[model samples]
Target: MKLYTLKTEIDAVPVADDFIAIEAPRPDCPDGGIVARVIYLSLDPYVGSRLRGRHMGEAPPKPMEGAIPGAIVGQVVKSRAAGVSEGDFVHAMEGGWQEFAAIPAGHFRKLDPKSAPLRAHIGVLGMPGLTAWAGITQLAKVMAGDVVLIDAAAGAVGGTAGQIARIKGASKAVGIAGGPEKCRLVTETYGFDACIDYKAEGWQAALKEALPEGASVFFENVSAEMAMTALSVSQTYVRGVLCGLADAYQSSGPAPHALNAGAIIGKRAQLRGLVVYDFYSRWDEYAAEAAAWIRDGKLAFAEDHADGLDQAPALFAKLMRGANVGKPIITVSEEQA
Candidate 1:
């Protein structure tokens, strides 16, 4: 077996040699565990913060010893648990940066390959997709005629949120992304009504111009400054779902943008913080509906994939820097055994 371990404490964006690949003994399947050959590794922006012990109370991986944590899709090769059999395709959060993982029985979910592509189980039809669905439908309650706003619109969560809003009857879906290419993807590919390039001068004004009716719902995935800007132009009683802070993940200290309490009060906004874990119980419900949407051409997703486990570190670095165009994933092995 081969795996990548942390070389040292990551200070900012990981560079070359941050992760060292080495051989290890294949993990034994425990009494209530299953050993599966990893197929796809989902590399999210939060991994960078988690490596530095900056994420939601997660401990940093020990240097040279701890395996990097991530969500993975794999086919079970050995099962010691009841209700699971060999060759069962599953998705689990504990799958590390390794060729094979020993996953506990209760820690994994059986994935229906026929529902969508196996890779989609970790992207659009997976946790990121669930996050977008929970924020838009469950929390924000996006309704017909509502104008929706999303930042990091090229990302899995934001892109899916905007599209879901449209599916749920929102009149217009607008996105704020980093550059022109991402903006183009948001509007042209994801089918958003408009996309504003946050990297360009006067983008805030551009966002306001694009949403003439004012945003009725805002699915926020960037920083507090961007959130405040969105709230400033939002309609009265707007629904706001605060999701990710991509800009603050690699920061050395507290985020520079201070939250403006007045913005929430002035707009009488209904604000909610979204933690995808809270909606885990509803995965099946969301996945079923989202998969149907995909088949019907009502939903879309983009993936930025790397070919092997060795490319994980570089691909992850690209994600933390907001350079990835879509969900960052690593193809560890073939999907089929």
Candidate 2:
């Protein structure tokens, strides 16, 4: 087996070779466990913070030890678990950055390749999609005629949330993204009503202009500055979902911009913090619904792919810097046998 391990403690955005490849014996299939051959590895922004011990309650991995953490879509090559059989395709968080993984029972979900693309199992039809579904449908309860806003609108969560808002009958879906290309993706590709490019001069003003009626629901994925900006133009009693703090993930200290309690209090906003793990129990429910949406062309998603296991570190580095256009994925092996 082959895997990548941490080469050093990550201080900021990891550069080249922060993860090193090494050879290891294949892990044995333990009692009530299955050994799977990894196919697609999911790379996410949160991994950067987790690697530095900055994420919520997750300890950093020792240098050159432990498999780097990630989610994977794979095929079971061996099984010791009941109800799970050899050759089953599954998705699990324990797969890590390795060619093969031993996943314990109850820690993995079976995937139907016919339901959607295998890669989609780790992207739009996977955890990112589940996150968006939980925040919009479960937390915010987006309703008809509501005006919704989202930041980081090109990536998986933000992109899917905006689309889900529209699907649920929101009158308008507005997005705030970094560049013209991503802004185009938000509006044209994801079907948002308008997209404001924050990198452009006067974008904050543009966001205000785009939302004349003010936002009724705000799905926040960037920084506190952006959150304040969105809140400034929000409707009274807006439902705000705090999904991710992409800007502050690399920092060793607290978030750079503090929350403005006054602004939130004045609006009487219903602010909810979204941690996706809390929604894991609903994965099957969400996947079934989202797969239908994808089959019907109602839900759209994007992915940025790297070719091999060795490319994981570079792709991860790109993700931490917010350079990835969509869900970042690594092709560890062929999806089909």
Candidate 3:
């Protein structure tokens, strides 16, 4: 099977042609496993951290080694596992970059494609959704009437968090996206009360204007500049939930703002960084609740799907450039006879 793995820590350039190939003997014990035909691969921001050995150590450089990072959902084409079988659509730790992935029986969750959008299992209902949920409910404990603001509001985490807050009974929801286009989306599609365009000059001022009373909760997705701006405008006792550093992901450096440490201390505000994996232990519980909300039409979500793993390299490049609208999932295969 062809696989992509990061082979170097080239911060400026990602060398894809350097991908090396190797053979794996067919597994001797296929009984407890499922050979999945990778359907959709999630090109998440967190994977960028794994490209380098220092930030996250998923694959160390060997120039001719792995060129693909894995985090995919697939359909079981062949399975010796009892509960799962051929034609079963599922989500797994294995990524869809490869044509085939043999996953342990226990790692796969059967996807009800009939009930929810098949692609959502890897997008909104997948890791990103979990990030939004855990970031809001678990960490910040967003409550009814809480003035909440989500940075990158039209993107994966922020968009969903803004909506979830309302479903959970927050009085107001504020969002921040790149421009007026997305700002409209935050208010219309995601049910946010207000949204700001960070790309617009004086965007921070817009944020302050939107929530003049000051945000009680900040669902932080992009940190540094946006974060400090939010902090400067935050109300006392606000809860800031940190998720990613997308604004500076492609750039190498310290956070832009040199805001005094007192901002947080004086406000007695809660700023906590979050990772989706930290709450994986509650996956089943979370998935069940989230799924029910979708069924009830309470939680709204969107997916940006790309066709083919071959499209992944370029697609991911788009993601890194912040061109994608929602969770970007590359569809590797469709139903076949």
Candidate 4:
């Protein structure tokens, strides 16, 4: 077995120095447990935050120096668990950046290969999808005829949030992304009502023009600049969900962005921050709805995939810098591809 374990605790984009790929003992399947051959590893921005050991009232980072901790999609090669068998595909938050993992049965969710691609289990139908769903359906509570605005609109969570807002009957679904290509994918490919390219000049004015009635709901990602922009254009009684703080994730000091209390007071807006893991109990419900939308062609997703486990470091760095267009995933095994 092989695992990409964290070897350094530095404040920087995780390079090869930060992670070491080494041979390790394969985990044994205990009673009520399954030993899985990991197939897909999710590359995300939050992984950087984990390496930096930033605790915002959340659990501490993995204590072991050579351990993996992130979402993964894998296949069971050995199973002592009831209702699970050899060759069963599964998803788990504990899969880590490893070739094999021994997981308790309760910690694994069986994935249907027939529903979608194996990589998608760690992507749109995985944690990122659930994150978006929780922000919109649970926190922001977007409603029909409402104007919804989302930042990082081309990324995994943002892309899904925009599409779900439209499907749920929001009057307008606006997306903000870095480049024109991603902007086009958000609107033209994912069916967002409009997507603003933040890299372009005068994008703020473009956002204002796109949402003439003001934003009723804001599914925020990225930094405080984008969050405050959403707040500035908010309608009376608007709702905002603070999802990610990408701007501050790599900084050595403090988070560079701050919330504008004046805007919240003036708009009489409701803003709530959420950690998706808190909604883990409702994953089955979200998966059911998301699968239906995907099956019916009402929802769409894209993947920016790297070929192997060794590619995880560079791939994760690409994702942090917003170089990848969609969900950044690593294909850890050839069988899963």
lDDT of each: 0.89, 0.89, 0.73, 0.83
Per-residue lDDT tens digits for candidate 1, residues 201-247, read: 99888888998889999988888888898998799999899998888
User: Which model is ahead, 2 or 3, in terms of TM-score?
Assistant: 2
Ranking by lDDT: 1, 2, 4, 3
Compared with the true structure, what per-residue lDDT tens digits does model 3 show for residues 1-337?
A: 5655444446642333434444433333256878877777888776554554434445543444443656677778788888886888878854435777777757677777776767777767788888899988999898888888888888878888887888777889988888787777778878888888888998777778888888889887776667777877778988988887775554445547344577789988888888777887787677778788888888777666778767777767777777777677787877442
Model 1 bad stretches (over 4 Å) = none
Estimated TM-score per prediction? 0.97, 0.97, 0.88, 0.94
lDDT of 4: 0.83
Number of backbone-clashing residue pairs for each candidate, in the order shown = 0, 0, 6, 0
User: Tens digit of lDDT per residue, candidate 2, span 1-337?
Assistant: 8988888787766665788888888999988889999999999878877887888989877777678999999999999988888888999977899999989888999988789888998889788899999999999999899899999999899999999988998999999888988888888889999999989999888989999899999999888888889999999999999989888875556666667999999999989999999999999889989999999999998889999998898888888777788789999999776
lDDT of 4 by residue, 152-259 (tens): 899899999988888888988999999989998898878888999989999999999998899999988887778889988778888999998876674556776788
Error of 2 at 297 (Å): 0.4
> In candidate 3, where is summed lDDT lowest over 10 consecutive residues?
20-29
The lDDT, on a scale of 0 to 1, for candidate 3 is 0.73
lDDT of 2 at 45: 79
Please tell me which model should have the higher lDDT, number 2 or number 4.
Answer: 2
The segments of candidate 2 whose C-alpha lies over 4 angstroms from its true place after superposition are 251-254
**Could you give the C-alpha RMSD of every candidate to the true structure, in order shown?**
1.2, 1.2, 2.9, 2.0
Candidate 1: clashing pairs of residues:
none
